[model samples]
Target: MLFKREFKRNLRSLIIWSIIIAGIILLYLSIFPSMAKEQANMDNLMNAVPSGMQKAFGMDRLSLGTLLGFYGIEIHLMTTLLGSIFAALLASGIVAKEQNEKTAEFLLALPISRQTIIAQKGAAVAANVALFNLVIVAASLIGFQFSSAQTLSYKAFFLLELAVFMMHLTFAAVAFLFSAVARRTRSIVSMSLGLVFIMYFLSVVAGISDKLSWLKYVSPFKYADAAQILTEQSFRPLYAVVMAVVIIGCFFAAYGYYRNKDIVV
Candidate 1:
C-alpha cells in the first residue's frame, strides 16, 4: 500500500523528467549529421578550444565526426546530470515531504514500522529510477536509428547506460540518506541539487588539474565518466566497487538513523 502510494505520487514528475532528458538527447543527436558534414571545420574548432576545456567536458578523447563520439561528448553530460537530478529530487523528498506537509504524525500513527516505511519508499525510488532509464535508453536507440553514423555498438551503448544507471543510484542513495535525517523538505531539495552539482564540479576540476586528480575518487560523476567509458568500453572495477560501497553505506545509515529519530506531532 505504501509503495503504491509513493510510486503514484512520484509518477508525474518521473514522466516530466524523462521527456525533458530524452528530448534533449534526441535534439542533440539530430544535429550530429550536420556537425559530421562539417567535420574538418569542427575539428579545427575543437583544436582551437583549450585542452583544459576539452578535458573538462569529456571531449579530449572523442571527436564530433563520429556518432558514438558525438553521443559520448555531447549527450552524455545531459543524460547523467539531469537524470541524477531527477533521482536525487525524487528520493530526497519521499520521506521528508510528509513532515513538511504536517502528515508525519498521521503516518507515524499507522501500524507500519519506520523500517517498513523506508523499505517501501526505497522500492518506489528503485522502480522510478529503473523506469526512467528504460525511457531514456529507448529514446537513445530510436535516435541512433535515424542517425547517419554507422550501426550503433549495442554492447558499448548498454555498458554506458549501465554506468549511467549506477550513477543515478549513487545520487539517489545519498539523497535518501539526507531525507532520512532531515525534516525540512526545502532544505533536502537544496542539498540534493547542491551535492550533485558540487560533485560534478569536482569531476571537471579533477580532469583539468593533475594535482587534484585524486578528487575524481570523491566525485560520483567520475565513476562513469563518458570519455573513459567510451574509450575503454568498460567500467573500472574500482569505480563500481566504490559506488556499491557508498550506496550500501548510505542506505544502511539512513535506516539506522530514521529508525530512532524523534518524530514531532
Candidate 2:
C-alpha cells in the first residue's frame, strides 16, 4: 500500500522529467550531424580551448566528430547531472516528508512496522529511478540512430548507460540516508542539489588540478567518467567496488538510524 501510494504520487513528475530529459537528448543529438559536418573547424576550435577546461570537461579525450565521442562528452554530462539531481531530490524527500508534513502520526498509528515503511519507500525510489532510465535508454538509442552515420560501439554505449544508472543509484542511496536522518524536509531539496553539484565540482577540479587529482576518488562522477569509460571500454573494477561500498554503507546506516530515531509528531 505504501509503495503503491508513493509510486503513484511521484508518477506525474516522473513522466514529465523523463520527457524533458529525452527531449534534451534528442535535441542535442540532432545537432551532432551538423557539428560533425564541421569536424575540422570543431577540432581547430577545440584545439584553441584552454587545456584545463578540456581536461575538466573530458573534451581532451573525446572529439566532436564521432558519435560516441560527442555523446560521451556532451550528452553524458547532461544525463548524469540531471539524472543525479532527479534521484537525489526524489530520495531526499521520500522519508522526511512524512514527519515534515505531519503525516507521520497517522502513518505510525497504523499497524505497519517502520521497517516495512522504509522497505516500501526504498522500493518505490528504485522503481522510479529504474523506469526513468528505461526511457533514457530508449531515447538515447533513437537519438543515436537519427544523429549519425557512423556505427556506434554498442559495448561502449551500453557500458556508459550502466554507468549512468549506477551514478543515479549512488546519489539516490546517499540522499536516502540523508532523508532518513533529517528532521525537516525544508532544506532537503537544496541540500541534495548542493551535494550533487559539489561532488560534480570536485570531479571537475580533480581533473583540472594535478595536486588535487586525488579528489576524484571521493567524487561519485569519477567512478564512471565518460572519457575513461569510452577509452577503457569497460568500467573500472576499483571504482565499481568503491561505489558499491558507498551505496551499501549509506543504506545500512540510514536503516540503523531511522529504526531508532525519535520522530517528533
Candidate 3:
C-alpha cells in the first residue's frame, strides 16, 4: 500500500518538484564560485545598492567573499520564496488531491484506519521535503568546495538548512489544516496560497512600517531569517522550536478534522 501510494505521489508533482529543485541546486552550485568571487566587493556593492533594494533585500551586512556568506545574501529571499511555496503547495494539495481527483472513496475503502491513511500521506509529504533539502545540501557542499576558505562548514550549513526545513514543514502543516477543514478543494488551495502570501506581505510591510513592526513576528519568515544564518551561522532556536510545535499541533488538528469530515465523493 505504501509502495503504491508513495510511488504514485513520487511520479506526480512531488518527483517533478524534486527534479526541479535538483536542477536548481546543480545550476546554482555550478556558478556559485564565480558568483562568490564577484560579490567580494562589499564597499562597491553596498554603496551602489539602491536604497529601495537595500530596504527590500536587507543588504546591510552582506559581504561578498565566502561562498556561504555570498550566497546567503544573494539567495536568502530565494530560499524564503521557494521554501514557503513548497509548503503552501504541498499542504494545499495533500488532502485536497484525494477530493479533487475523486479518489477519496477509493482511498478510504482500503483496510487501513483513517489515522493510518493520514499518517501515510503525511510521511509522503515529509519525504518530498527531505529530498528537496538533501539536494540543497549537496549543492551547498559543491559550493563549499570552491570557497576561499577552501573548506566546508558542514554543521553550520546543515543547521541553517534545517531551519529552512522546519519552516517548510510548518507551512505544510498549516496548509494541510486548511485543506482538511475547507469545504472545497480549490478553496483550500486558494486559501493556502493566500495564507502564505499574507504572512510574506506582513513581513515586508513590517520592514517598511515601524507601526507594524509586530507583523514580523506573524510571519514564519521572521522565525527563519536568512541574514541571521549567513552572519551568525544559526537562527533563533526559540522560533524554530515554536514553529515545529505549531506544525505538529496543526497536523494532528488536520487529522482529527478530516477524520470527522463528511465528503460527497
Which prediction has more favorable lDDT, 1 or 3? 1
lDDT, candidate 3, 75-124, per-residue tens: 65566667678768876777777878888888888888878877777777
lDDT of every predicted structure (CA atoms): 0.89, 0.89, 0.71
Instruction: For candidate 3, report its TM-score.
Output: 0.87
For candidate 1, the TM-score is 0.96
- The whole-model C-alpha lDDT of candidate 2 against the native structure comes to 0.89
Worst 10 residues of 3 by lDDT: 143-152
Ranking by lDDT: 2, 1, 3
Query: What TM-score against the true fold does each predicted structure earn?
Result: 0.96, 0.97, 0.87
* RMSD list, candidates in order: 1.2, 1.2, 2.5
Q: Give the poorly placed runs of model 3, Cα more than 4 Å off.
A: 2-4, 36-42, 50-56, 148-152
Pull out the clashing pairs in model 2. none
Clashes of each: 0, 0, 0
Q: Could you tell me which residue pairs clash in candidate 3? A: none
lDDT for model 1, on a 0 to 1 scale? 0.89
